[model samples]
Target chain A: MLTLFYILSAITLGTAFLTILSKNPIHSAIYLVLCFFSIAGHYLMFNAQFLFIVHIIVYSGAIMILMLFTIMLMNLNKADEKNKPILSRIAAVVAFCLVALVLLATFIKSQPVINEYKVSGQDFQSIKVLGQVLLNNYMVPFEFASVLLLVSMIGAVLLSKKEHINN
Target chain B: MDQAIIIEKGIFIVVIFAITMLFAMYETLAERKIAAWFQDRVGPNRAGKGGILQPLADGLKLFSKEEFFPNTENRFLFIAGPAISMTTALMTSAVIPWGDKLTLFGRDVILQATDINIGMLYVFGVLSVGVYGIMIGGWASNNKFSLMGAMRASSQMISYEVAMGLAIICLVMMTGTLSLGEIAAGQHGWRWNVLYQPVGFIIFLVCSFAETNRTPFDLAECEAELIGGYHTEYSSMKMGFYLFAEYASMFISSTILAVLYFGAYNYPGMDWVESVAGANIANIIGIFVLFAKICFFIFFYMWVRWTIPRFRYDQLMKLGWKMLIPLAIANIIVTGIIILLADQNL
Candidate 1:
């Protein structure tokens, strides 16, 4: 399990670096996808199969696709797509490095190491168990999530249609 | 599980995984041959006998082909598109029960790779992930047509998923269990649920075609408009993975359809086979029976593909949402009512 955890975590971080380092917009998008997938792998390693699938659905299935469609629609392939100049790029890189260094230091210090680990199997996984808890204990939030999705869907359609209406 | 059981399960997983890859490879050949027959032409007889070995020849061709990338934004996303699709397609097989239990050396050997009780749900979850492959591939292509294709895929998939989920909910309510093996067991000995839940079966069957991205529901790669669809920019082996994964999902999903609703490894008078041929021989026959059912579904998929025309986007959405969803909900309610009445009589 530790081996699995390390592999997934490395993939997550490595893909993130590649996501930034990759020159091509399509390549970056692909790396972003790789990052999302690695995160999903992490979810599975943590025994959250439902979360893993949901993450893939939300991020890989929908969000990344939305991004891809946006990129294609805008015809940003010939150039790097970023309008920011070289000066901004250098500053952004420096800031990113600083942020990463600090975050890494903090993560190492804050990492949780389980010694005598014990967790109830039913509590850890299973939709039936999750469903019971969700409806009873977290029903408000669960319902709210649907409302959030509805809001976003409406927003997207409205925004996409703005171009049509204006024309 | 003990060490020996663990070892056995490992071997079982390997075998099942290999079988899935092999079936998927062959399905590609079968699809081309089928399409050829429909067109009154011989397909790829040059590669091997009756074009049986054509898949390997095609695979080699893919490898030897030149690769090119259109200057595109987000090259990472471009590569990620097909990889996601391929992996997700293979993931669904983790829970499918391939055959009935085999008794060896006084030990009961289950035929599934992993009988994790939440098997059906797992398949649905993984199947949903295939949408990303199309969406991302299209987007990463950085072409107008590709983006349109991806957008079409996303909307179509999400809409159909509601009906698909409802169909599954109906099945779950009837079986009272989520385990695939248990589902197969329930449909044993000619007492298949298709007879009982014909409407449910039909809904599931239709949705499966869409879920697998077969023709009529294959809006993602409609060559008529989308210029090769999601994989327009991809070339060579990278492209082949996306195409191969679709067939892989098609074959595996068809198998799941057979095992779940149709009588998997079970036919009328299956008991008599065991009586005459003995347990070992009968179980082998059962495996063959399951294979025959899978072939029938594969043919059924092709038949439908050639028969129906591609749906307009709005029309597809309406069917999934208005017609299918409502019907599935009604089916669930009706099933509950019947089950309750039966319990009261008991």
Candidate 2:
């Protein structure tokens, strides 16, 4: 399972890199989807079923679909190849690379690798345990999440809709 | 590292993969047949008995057809779109418990190909990735229709996802279990969670329909407007892949629905089957039972597809943001209150 996890993670990381590097938005989007699936696989490797399904539903299902809509609405598929100022693109790439390097180095140093151990416990990824914790221990945060959703909903509606026509 | 266990899991996965592919292909046939039936005529009965072999014939034709590559700019991205869609669609079944465990040759062979604790979350995570497939395919197609399709697919999926998550949260609250197998086990009879979480079930059902890119909710590939939608320019195997992946996802989504809402592999008299036929055989039979449930869902997908007209873009957005999300949130509140009252009584 550890080996499988490592393999999946490598594939995910490699795909994420390819997603960014791909000149075409569609190609990048597709690669990004693969990266998402690979991450979901890692979630499965850890036995987080509810999270896995939700990951697919929210990220792959909803967010990706929105991204697709944005891409189409903008008609940016093949237009990406239109030559831009080379210096700017090069500078942007360099900046991104520097950020990636710093982030990777810091992350590697901050988190020490631990020896692998046999997985043990009741495997409380079950909905029952999640419910108990969500309703009791994390009730405040849970309620807040709902409030956040409500705000976002209102924001989306307000942004999408025209001002009231009341005269 | 026993050879038998390796072979066991390997065979199970391969078989499931094959079944999924076949189901997807059949779903295409079913979609067309259902559409034709709705229109009062025979569908494709030329290929085989009642068109049983149509999907295979279609596959062969696709394999033999010319793979056209329009002189589009993002050729690589265009090529990658269908591949992503197909891969993610099939990848989701890894954690689903198809049936109970079977004891064979002094070993308990798990019916599921893989049983991880975060199975539900893993499925969710993979679903998010699924967006890339469509987005990439559309953007790469270098066509307005394709791009538009991809865009619609993304926004529609994302919006519904929030409501879907909220709906699932209610159930997640009620059952207090995230692992699908346990969810199924918790509802071991006709006393399915659907009865308890009616609002959640409806919301989840609607979201699932939207998530799967089915009709009425399918603003992404509305053929009347988009002219064949995202795969408009795709031909040969590339087109086949996109279509195949849709079916595969439909089947998987239906299974997820059954496992979550319906008593998955748990009929009313499931104990009798285990008692009479013994655990292993009964479980194998239970797998068949689960398949039947999934077929009905696939049928339902087709039935609704033909029966309803697609929603306009704004209507689709409104359904997701204004209607479903609020309803789901309300359901959560109701469930919370119920749980609170129950706790007080106890």
> Over the stretch A31-102, how does candidate 2's per-residue lDDT look in tens digits?
786688788788777677666666666666666666755655665746566777999999999999999999
* Per-residue lDDT over B1-346 for candidate 2, one digit per residue giving the tens place of the 0 to 100 score: 5888799899999999988987888888888898899999999999878999998998999999999997687788788889989999999898888887878888898878776666676677677777778877887777878877877887687778778878888877787766777887788857788889988989988999998998888777787799888889999999999988888999999999988888788777778878898888788787888889998988888888877888899988988889998899999999999999998999
Instruction: Give the Cα error of residue A137 in candidate 2, in Å.
Output: 9.3
Off by over 4 Å in 2: A1-167
State the TM-score of candidate 2 restricted to chain B.
0.96
lDDT of 1 by residue, B117-204 (tens): 6777677667666776777677767787877877787777777777877888877888887888898888879888788788888898
Q: What is the TM-score of each candidate's chain B when compared with the real chain B?
A: 0.95, 0.96
Model 2: C-alpha RMSD to truth? 5.3
DockQ of each: 0.30, 0.48
Q: What is the lDDT of residue A21 in candidate 2?
A: 91
Give the winner by TM-score.
2
Prediction 1 TM-score vs. true: 0.79
